[model samples]
Structures are given as C-alpha cells and as structure tokens.
Target: MSATLPNGSVLSLATTYGAAIPMTVLTNAAPPVATATAHGLTNGDILEVTSGWLGLDARPARVAGSTTNNFNLEGHDTADTTKYPVGSGLGSVRKVLTWTQISQVMDPATSGGEQRFVNWNYLEDGNASERSKPTNRSAKVLTLKLADDPAQPWNAVLAAADAAGTPRILRLALPGGSFLYYNVYVGFDPEPSLSFNNIMQLTVTLNSAARFIRYAS
Candidate 1:
C-alpha cells in the first residue's frame, strides 16, 4: 500500500508567518510607475519592499494596479537616482495576506506530482543518446480536492478571482512530521463537476513554482 499525507495538513500563505516573497526589479520608474516583473500582486494589496533600493526598503506601500509581469506602487511620487543602480540586485517584495484567516482542509484523493528534467548524452561512435543526465529537479506539486465549503478560508481566494495578481504559499505537513512548502498560484477552479446532491467537490492544482523546501521533525 502507498502511504500518503492525511487531510489535516495545513495550507497557509507565507505571510501568515511573516515571510516575504522575493521579487526582481526590472524598471525603476518614478513614483507614479514603480515596476517589477511578475510581482503577483493585486490592487490594494499591501507590500513591503526591502534590500534593493534604499528608498523603497522598510516601507509599507499599497499596490495601485498590476499586470501579469508588472506592478506599480501607490502614492510613491518620487524617483531615486540610485534606484536599482549599478551593482544593485533585486529586492524582496512580499504581498501581505490575511494571516489570521483559517486554513482550508483538503479532502482525500489529493495527489502530488513531480516534474523532473533530464538530458541525454551520446557518443560519436554510438547510436542515439547512450546515457541520460539529470538537468533540473523541480518542486513537488499537489492537487487539492476540496469539498465545497463556502465558509472555508480558501473561499476568500476563490472570491478574489484574480489570477495574475495573486499568488500564495502552501505548507503541508505529512504523517511523519515532514513538511513541504510551495509558492503557488490559486487558479479559480470555477467549474467543478456537479453531482446529484452529493457534496460539491472542487479541485485546485497547487503548482510549486519554486523549490520545495523541506523540513524534518
């Protein structure tokens, strides 16, 4: 029999534990157009920028608007000449989520997936690729099968309905006291298969865009 994690594993945003998301600064627009690539922030979302530009660090700002690859900060009307200056790298920008929100308990049948990339090698005297080599090891992903519960904390994510702007972090603890963390985009599973009076079921795919950091008990 295959062992699996129980349904009680927690899925909470990183902000809940005061962790911040790291973002790369692509444009140093004036206050009216502070820009970063793929920020994953929604309008009115609170953000804290740190460690890139001195002017932006350690300040609480609100997002005015954002596209899939860009975001503009609200109320910052000045630009810094040294903004993202030479030798300066990216900063950390975290979208603050409701830390106090309850976590949604996933139903059974939730499955995990892995994406591994490998490359083949061949010798001039040999046929096709004689051997294979590992290229990249991606994060482990989980598909959450959730019973429809309008009162669940995940309901807020569903109601937001913003994909390009909002992303979250999920922390899952397995039966053996091991933990896995994933930064994911909660695509609104708007169309769940319907049944006759059975409890409604919705499936949300939590793609791990980053490394699956693990912790042991």
Candidate 2:
C-alpha cells in the first residue's frame, strides 16, 4: 500500500520566504531611504510597493541600494520631504506559511459572488426564484488555525498589516507541486481561547483581496 500527503500540505518556510518586507519611511532624502530591519533582500530584487509614499502604488520598484536596516528606492524621489510624510509603510509583501504555525488552511472559493431574485405572483414565472444578474463577487476568505507564535514570520507580516492597514500575499504549494497564491488581508490577534491543558491555538481569518491563482510548479 502507498501513502499520500494531504493535498493542502504547505511546502515552504514562512520565516525566510517572502517577496518583500514592509519598509518604514525615513530621512526623506532624494530617492528615499526606507527601513526594514534584517530585510534579507538583495540589490535589484524587483519589489511591488503599496501606498508607502504619497504617490506609490502596486508598481514594480527595485532596490537600488541597501544597508542592514535601510534601502534606497530606485528613481523614486520625494521633492518636498515635508509633504511626503514619514511612517507610511509598504504592503502586498508576498509570503509563505509555516508547517507548524498553521494547523489547516481551508480551500479557497468565492464566498458569495452571485445574486438571485424571486418572481412576483403576477410575473408568470414557473419557478419560485430566478437567477438574477451576478455582480460584486468577493474573493474567497481563507480561514486558518495557527499555533500562536510570536516569533513566526506570519506574525510579523500580520503586525505590519494591522499597523499599516495593508495586505500581504499568501502562497501555498500543494503536494503535487502546484502553487496556490492569494492576496490576504489578515485579522490581527483574534480572541484566544485556551484551556489549562490543551495547546494554545489562534484562529486567523484571512480575506482574499483577489481571486486565487494556481500555477504549475
């Protein structure tokens, strides 16, 4: 007999695996120097930023220079340092989940994208309800059970999300080598329910900012 792993088994280290880290605005120098401690990023690594500055978006930006806690944004300038306020952090940082931190990740699907309508008595409709136009389809909300760990990578990302009001990306590599990616807005520190004998667990609810995409590994 052969044994198989769960389809949703995660296959990446959450600590050292992420596309980008949230950067704290600093100095207001020409080609701003941002702060992200121990970012572990290299020069020329392509980065997509959120509203870290007044005019920044999810545009592809690169790391022109770097230090231990700071990096310079290539070709990005804040002509008036006073106007470009500091402390606006970046988001949409892509990251993976840890095997131990996460107990399970529910499958992704549209929570409620389609709408339905009911026919009136004089409408002469054969059925009680008819399909109405479908609109405002929200992306799937992925729920996860995590063993609360302050040192985990996801916790740091979640802290930035809560403090900066931005979302991050969650990537999952299935057992078959296919990848599932989603932009997740996480809830910071949900109510912890623990017992005197059981392991402490936290329930994290992640709302997908866009539809999940699957790609071959």
Candidate 3:
C-alpha cells in the first residue's frame, strides 16, 4: 500500500469545449456503449456527457473500445432500467478542449456527496423492525480558498463563469499525476476578507452538477 501528499497539486478550469456529438443510443449494459455516428473519438478520450438519465447526465466518462460509430463508457453501468429508462438515455457528449490553471490556491475543501436512502416499515409490526435502501447520492461542493489578486488573468475567467451561470469542468491534478474532474457551476465571491497582516483571500465554490470522475496516474 502507498499514499501520496497533495503538496504539489494544482487546479484548473476548462476554458473551451468541442462541439457536442449527438449520442443516438446508450445500451443498458455494464460499461454501457454509446452510439454516435462518425464519432471520431479515439480510445482513452475523456468526454463530458449530457444525458436524460440523472445518473448519467453531466458526468465525465472515459472512452474505450472506440469504433466508427460507437464507444464504451469505460466503467459506467446503466443496466438498471428502473433508474436509466430506455429511449430516454440519449444525449450528447462534448470534449474538453483546453484548461486554464488557477494559481495561488490556498486551501481546498470538499463537502456533500452523501448517499441518501429510503426507509420502510411494516404497517402492522409487533417487532418494530425497519428496513432501508440506498437511493441517489448528493452532488459535491468544492470550496477553494485562494490568495486574491485582481490582476490575475484567471480571476476574470472566474467572474465570467459565475456571471454566465453555466456548468463547466474543473480538474484537480494531484502530486503523482492523478486527476479528479468535476462538472460544476462556478460561484465567485466578489468580496475578499480583510485581516491584519495576512494575504487578502477569497473563496470560490464549485457547485457540482454530477459525480466526479477520477483518473489514476
């Protein structure tokens, strides 16, 4: 077993995205296959998916077994038709084209993504026994504390994203090259905190739109 520290980690934001490739069909199977005519996506390409299925929409999926018209979502499973209904799973995929690094990041905190459950009890139970089943998970929120500098170029980008209120991609690169990517709507707090001698700082909240995708080095 091994572990690595996050001392050298970096954070980046997606600056551009390729045109959406319409997915004609998504199979209900392990490692679900997506059908998109002339997709042109190569194996190992990362795609930002937008689908009708809540479990799949706005998620980042890695591509594999790429063919002219189809490719597999590397580790996704959509076999449970109850959650991912047939004929309603069709959506589009967009490739993240570029990323801009956000420097001077101080402390990053993540919250939420807690799994929710449904509880049930018998109508007439002398023993008072209850059962529970897991349901959908909550979206995560990443709050980043940064040294505020109005002159930073990326500050303008963050402002624009907050103003647009559109979901974009955020990538966190760990020390050993592993990455965690999220689909989020950027929230910028315009006011910075004032202190005695400490550096001026501000916080930016990344409200996740879907589950995060992790890639090992």
All candidates: TM-score:
0.49, 0.47, 0.84
Which pairs of residues collide in model 3?
none
> Per TM-score, what order, best first?
3, 1, 2
Q: In terms of lDDT, which candidate is stronger, 1 or 3? A: 3
lDDT of 2 by residue, 1-217 (tens): 8576666567221232355476654546667676778876567543445555545554334565878877765565655746766555354333232322343334433354445444344367655665455345445575565666655665665555656555555556678776565555766674555889865666666675544445555
Q: Candidate 1 has which clashing residue pairs, if any?
A: 38-69
In TM-score terms, candidate 3 sits at: 0.84
What is the lDDT for 166 in model 3?
92
By lDDT, the best candidate is 3
Q: Local distance difference test, per candidate? A: 0.55, 0.55, 0.87
Q: Where does the lowest 10-residue lDDT sum fall in candidate 1?
A: 100-109
- Better candidate number, 1 or 2, judged by TM-score: 1
For residue 90, what is the lDDT in candidate 1? 54
